[model samples]
Target: MSMNVSEFVWKRLQEWGLHRVYGYPGDGVGGLDVALEKAQGSDGSGMEYVQVRHEEMAAFMASAHAKFAGGVGLCYATSGPGAIHLLNGLYDAKMDNQPVVAIVGQQARTALGAHYQQEVDLVSLFKDVASDYVAIGTVPSQVRHMVDRAVRIAQNKRSVTCIILPNDLQLMAYEDPPLVHGTTHTGVGFPAESKLPEQEGLQAAANVLNEGKKIAILVGAGCLHATDEVIAVADKLGAGIAKALLGKAAVPDDLPYVTGGLGLLGTKPSWDLMQDCDTLLMVGTSFPYSEFLPKPGTARGVQIDIKGDKLSLRYPTEVNLLGDSAVTLKALLPLLEQKTDTSWRNTIKSNVEDWWKVLEERAMHSAEPINPQRVFWELSPRLPENCIVTADSGSVANWYGRDLKFRRGMMGSLSGSLASLGAATPYAVAAKMAYPERVVIGTIGDGAMQMNGMNVMITISKYWKQWSNPHLIIMVLNNRDLNQVTWEERVQLGEGKTESTQSIPDFPYAKYAELIGLKGIFCNDPDKVGAAWDEALGADRPVILEFYTDPNVPPLPPHITLKDAKNFMTMIPDEPELGSVLKNSAKELLSTVLPGR
Candidate 1:
């Protein structure tokens, strides 16, 4: 059979069961794009090109797709700048340990060393970010084998992989059979008991967990498939469970021992439990915030992770178990002994309940405008249990971390690794694409909403009705400030005033959505917040709900430091409007310090 490299690559990608790829069309990639179009139009092709306004958004969508769907996400871009745009999002996947494959169409082979237009040393440029593997196609016969290697490496390594296709190679004819190594599947999951660690490690973990009183389990995304086992372990040991942000849905928030996400986005009960625990059982998460764990020498630790090296990366470990989270937890559950005393468990439950009350009071507080926390608090109960919620970084993440209770069976995230802005829309778009039957909600701040969102919003509008029940809802909070960073600056600087530079201009983001052929609901008045959300949620197509929120609302940390208070005091004087935020925080502080109910 006579075929070009692009034809062979697309056929193998189709066989790999990747029906959709995200990217923007650009120079030097005309051959691949043509091949992609042909593949989509053919019968049983099961392939679609998701054209995005920017190549970067394409990469962001692919990264989120990998995180949410647990598959090797595919993204493509032309050579040079189109290829460069993928780095930030690819790095997001790399840093967060997700599988992603970036395919870039390169300059023609004849253009080598000629400094041709739109030429770049893509393999070298991608090495730091796409470190799992990077290769360029030269021979037409090698196309299938290269795609096979890229997919397998990405899936096995849980990292980013890149394959470059020179324009000339993409159009070459060859006679060869495909040499593929993987099929269309999410890849290695539960029921694989063979992956469990040796008995020695499991027994050691069991002993540490059994002997320790006031044990706390910190769960990460690795615990996603092991929720039942995680809950069982917690129940048996009478341990409190704190989640890393990536593991927000590891267990239901309503569970007695399951304190919500830890670190800055953590709940107060999570802080209290981790702070007081004598032993910490770490599961499936490289949580990265060692400061949030129990004090040095305060808690002995046992960590279980699929990656052996990550077992004790964030905290000291007394026992290190290597295995898949579900498989390992199932094995360890039988070895654990039930605790007789309920005092520690009861203490954690009370803190979790009390924290909710405190959060509610804070969220419900009436500001001159609207309290941003109230938006999430109100949306929490209404969030469909099956919905996927993605939140952008900044002050909005504060509300998401604190108020948005992640029920079981939800999947979503922001720029967790890159901590970059403008990912919420792309994530929601990808979630809706991957599982269009479920509802997709994205809560973003005006700062991030204006950055990469507008473009992806158009992408959502373009693709919303293509599949079933996309139910895409984008809530843009126009707080008119780079609120998260502004808050960080105040805490870090101690005495500096927030200059005008920190403030953002309030744009009618909802209005913009309406203009772009989607539903737009805008709310500035405190009284109308519910109606806007309700309307956006009820809409069949994608809807943008932009709220004019009070920027004075602060994202209070799980545990406040003296520096935080001092900075809050210093800044509250300059912006007296933020006094309400300080007062609300103090109320929680008082509640914590004051004794029994």
Candidate 2:
């Protein structure tokens, strides 16, 4: 069998160390599909192709794969709509700074300008999202460099890149670029280099950190691999550590000085730490909310990041150390004076203890059916050792941020900057694919579950048996309302919940799981939330754990500003679930001070 353009493309990707691809099939990619079939063979002995129900899900899975597996994620799609479907997930990768390469099928070269069937200008469509690099293959010779550059750029820049393959060109006879002036040649592989800040810059940062009596450390996804370094520096400075949502797993929640997540979906301890700190050490995190940080001139700042452009972006830093998170922290650690006065650290630990108790009270508070927080609160202690978890956007993210305790060895991520709904399911699927030995779990709101999570369950159903440990669980908060947006309208826009927009039709999520050959468990009882998780964790196959939750229970912010309070109060008169909303809010708020209740 002679090599074709499609064959060479896959071969090159394999050489570059990408062994898996998440994608959906279409006629536009018929040649590639044929080539993939030949490559995988009857024994399934080649590139792993995850056939996602939708192209969008494929891109999301690719993004998750990159995050969990620490490699360049790859996804494929057909022409027009399929190519367009990849944008949302690709944008998710771009915003979150994950490396993902998308190989999209395009209309034939002759039909491209003619606007023939399924004809779309893919290059222009992908230009913005894949701003670093996007190219279309016009001939078989161009395919080589296109693959090499796309993978290399995506990996090195930690951004999305695209290679558009026209249908006609995909089936063409493969050929190396001729040794002529007009032709180009390319090779595979991105070599690793030790990235470190200069000693002078490290010393400057240490000086700022050393001068302050109270210090706060904020870590994001960039610090995932630098957990030890982060802990060491925080201990040295006697600082309290706060995590950005994307950095939930960067440091274990068990540490007394680790104040959980920051921002709207953060902890009160974290809020208080930032408000009081005299110094801020930001490591590999471009956590967007500047308000959650120390007020300007209140704290001296030192930021360390690999990307020079991202340095001092969120806060004004006295020293912007440009280097890898682990490398920079290691160098800076030696110059830092170990704090002998443990007063600041003790205060932070006390605050963290009080915050956790408050969370427990809130989670245990009574609701119409179940408090969504309780579901996660129960799962926190029950989370399987070394399990990988993913959460979707909406009210669920609030519980995901506050209630769950991430221990070391456990991995968790979601749509961070993008904050898109319908990402949890695909992320869990990809995590399972990458580490089949470990258990994976996904927490999704009903809104997100209906939008994309339910569909990705079918993908899970198709591949569950192949995994070594069949313990993937999808937990759906069946609130029958777009709860997050409803609360946002009340708190942010000062409007009542619009039934027309907020109410989503209730679906039998657990039943749907059973219908698809997976285990299903529904729990509306608060007492049974933990038991349901146990059942799901011990299931013989993938399971859908549905919790019939109360949507009226507000996902309160860590620190509600006076304006936010006023805005929320303004919506009370017209709010449809006025009684329940007011009651839940009161109970949640009182949980903080009402000791031993």
Candidate 3:
């Protein structure tokens, strides 16, 4: 049987080791759908087509698939609106530096310039996000090279790429490039190699670290595979480590010297570590918030990164070592002289110990109905071993960042730089698909849950039974407000929460889960949060665990500066939930000074 261009595209993706493609059905992609159907009927060439409720979710799942599975994630969408819907998620992948390739459908080639229905200039639309590469398939011969280039570039650059397939061309028989001028041939696979810095550069970085009295190390997603190397370097320097939000899983929080997350959703220990350190060694992190880092001219900096562009961009480095995280660290280890003074390490440990206690006090702090922090506080110890965690952008992320302590072997991520809402559920779905035997959990705010998270529950309902481990849990913090933004307005803009803009309608999240043939558990009582988690985790199928949480409980930053203090104080007089806000704010502040009381 002669292979159509559409069939050839799928086969080419499979050759590059992609077994799953997340997408939705539309007439713009009808030819591709027919090819997919044929492939599905065949014995071994079939790809798992995860039909998502929205194209945006498909893109997000692809991003998550790349993040969790460590490969080029594949997603497809039909013309115009469907292609447009993928932008937000693709931006998430781009900002976080994950590899993802989008296969976009276009209207018939003949009608492109006629302004026919669904005729979109996809190449123009994708050029910014997929800035590394974006190409259109005008000929059957172009399909092979397009797929090859898209997959290879996405993986090599660790960024987004797009291949636009016209519906008319997709149905034509695929043809190999001819032995003639103007023809191009491309191959599958990017070779594996380890990059290491020069010995002189490694020694310079080591000397800077050895001379410092108090050193702080920052790691991001780049250190995910370099955990042991990071630990070794930190131990050698007697340094404390801070993890970027996207690099939460780079090192387990159980380490005494690991100071949780950094920046706005960061911990007090991390803030102190940065403030007090005389030298900074940033490994594989481009943590965006410079205000949260050591002030300029205060700390001497040294940075290691695979990308030279990312090196020293956040901090002014005395030495910049360009190499892969683990490889460079391994070579640099022999040059580092072990620190004899344990005072700096001891101070960090003390601060970290006090910080955890402060979190517990805040989590246990009483609220109007349920403290949102307590919900996550209760979940920390209950997390299943080796589970993959996902959180959407909202107040939920604050707790996910601050409270949940991830152990070694666990995996997690979110929309880091983009921080888009409605991403958690789809990310969890992709994680579960990638590792069927592992548990997965997604924490989302009520606003995000209603936006598109609920629709993804339908996607889960469609596929949960196929997973070997059916322990996927979606936890909704039902606070009835655009909680994170409301707090941001208060803290950043010194403005009161505008009722029309900040408030969201209440929905029965748990009930909706039940309606879709999944387990649903609803809890309003703060005391039973743990029991609710237990019930959901032990359920026979996937579960939606909804908690009626207090919206007034502030997601406070680690160390509130005077500017933020003034802004927060300015908003208090006109705040809608004034009393609850005052009470919770007092408790949260007191937690820092009155730990273990």
Candidate 4:
């Protein structure tokens, strides 16, 4: 049977078990649209082509799907502009080490060498981002091999891979005998086959750790499944655990020694512990901010990681253990000696306890306009046990980093590596799709919501029912300004107040959701925040819940430096309009007077 290349590609995708793919339609991908239509007509036997408004979002949705579902994510886009649009989202996967495959449609093969319209050197453009594998499938015979190679590299290596298919080749008759399909089983297998350093290396690392009095453990996303082993190591050494933002759930926050994230988004205990520790045991994290860690030569260091190249990338190390976090910790436990001194552990716990009180005072403050901290404070406990929360990078991320608490089984991220905006909606939609029975929540500021929220909400309405009992709730902190940028002006740029240029108009996003047949609620009264959650939870369809929060409320750093303090006091008073903005919403910071204990 002579099968067209497009149909052949789609058939192999089915064989590989990729059920749903995201993309936008255009002429360069006309062959794909035809195959997709045929698949849709065949009554659910082939892949579901999820239609998205923008190719950027299609890629983001795909990346998030991989993150939440634990497999290679799939997305497609057409020719130049559409191909370019996938870069940002693909980078998110690249930086986080998530496996994602992007398929780009090129102009016809005959037009490739010429400066044809909408044709780009996709191989060159995608080289850096999809460094694992980037290739062009030039002829019909290469389609299956190209697709299979991309899928394998993306999954086995946990990186991004791209394949460029010219429009002409997509329509050509596939004459090669079909390779045996559906016999492959490269399922997601992890807690990865135990990898441990040699016995001598493990002993040398233990010797360095054992020599120091004040030890601290900094863990990253690589420690996701080694909670007990990590806790055992911490308990054995009487060390405190400080998590990287990506590894927030590596171990539960309820443990006395598990100080939360490190860096700008870190907790007070985490900052203090890193500052005072004489020894640091780094595990599985590639946290880039060296300033937040113990100053290089000040502490004895030992690193345990699966990647040897990443062993001491962030800090100078005395010993490097090239192994998986779980396996290495388990192996090292017997070699570790139990600490007899409880004073250091007690001091750390006391500081953490007091920090909670400080956080509570800030969250419970009675301000003129609602405090943004209160929103997260309320949302924290209200989240269902099986919920997954995604916070965009901004002031809201600070609130999430400081205030939002993840129950043991819950999972989340704060756009840690890319630190991009407008990812909350795409992340939440993918989370809801991957885990239909769990509640998915997105907490974003007005700026991020306006950028990519509305379209993905529409995407949710399209494929929502495909999952079993899917529930998606987006909480928009609409303060009528780029709240994070406004605060950055106050401190980072040494400016007194916000300017109109950093502002956004308050759109009735709730009304927009309602108009589109989804539930919408625009809330201003702070007292009703809980009630909005109730109403949203009651609705079967997706819901948009917007809260008008105080734009003046800043995300104060956990550990303020002399430079940050100086920046706060150094105010820019030159702008004439600054005074009026203060007069109008100066009340935005009523709680600013409260002691940030």
Q: Cα lDDT for residue 269, model 3?
A: 94
**How much lDDT does candidate 2 score?**
0.92
TM-score of each: 0.94, 0.99, 0.98, 0.92
* Model 4, residue 458: C-alpha shift (Å): 1.0
| Candidate 2: tens digits of C-alpha lDDT, residues 1-597 | 579999988888988999899999888898899898877757876788989999999999999999999999999999999999999999999999999999999888888789699898888999999999999999888889999999999998999999999988999999998999998888777968558978888888888999999999999999999999999999999999999999999999999999999999999999999999999999989899999999999999999888888998989998998889998898888899999999999999999998999999999999979999999999999988999999999989999999999999999999999999899999999999999999999999999999988889998999999999999999999999999999999999888899999999999999999999999999999999888999999999999999999998889998888999999989988898899999999998888768348
lDDT on C-alpha atoms for all candidate structures: 0.82, 0.92, 0.92, 0.82
Candidate 1 C-alpha error for residue 59, in Å: 1.0
Q: How close to the true structure is residue 418 of candidate 2, measured as C-alpha lDDT?
A: 93
lDDT of 4 by residue, 1-597 (tens): 667988888877777778778889788888987887886556765687778878988888888888778778999999999999999999998888888999889999889889999989999999999998999977676777678888888876778999898888889998553456633323222234448889999999889888878999999888887888999999999999999988887787767777887888778899999999999999989899998988888999999987777888989988999998999999999999998898889888987776666666777665446778888888877878868888888888888877877768888875669988988888887787678889888989889988988888888888777777757889889888887777677767777655567778879989988888888988787787778888887788888888887776557766666776676667645433455444433332333334353
Off by over 4 Å in 3: 41-45
Q: Which lDDT tens digits does candidate 1 get at residues 1-597?
A: 666777777777777767789988876688888888888876634577889998888888898998888777999999999999988888888888888889998898889779989888988999888887899887766676678878888877788999999888887885454445632223222122346899988898999888998999999889988999999999999999998888887888877667888998778888888889999999999988888998879999999998877877888888998889999999999999999999999999888887788777777667658888889988988888689999898888878877887778877678885788988988888888888899989989998888888878888878877878857899988878888887777665654346567877768887898899999888878777777778888887788888888776667787788877777667655653456556655554564565233
Query: What's the TM for model 4?
Result: 0.92
Residue 195 accuracy (lDDT) in model 4: 84
Cα RMSD to the true fold for all candidates: 3.5, 1.0, 1.1, 3.8
Clashing pairs in 4: none
Residue-wise C-alpha lDDT for candidate 3, range 317-382, written one tens digit per residue: 899998999999999988889999999999999999999989998999888789999999999999
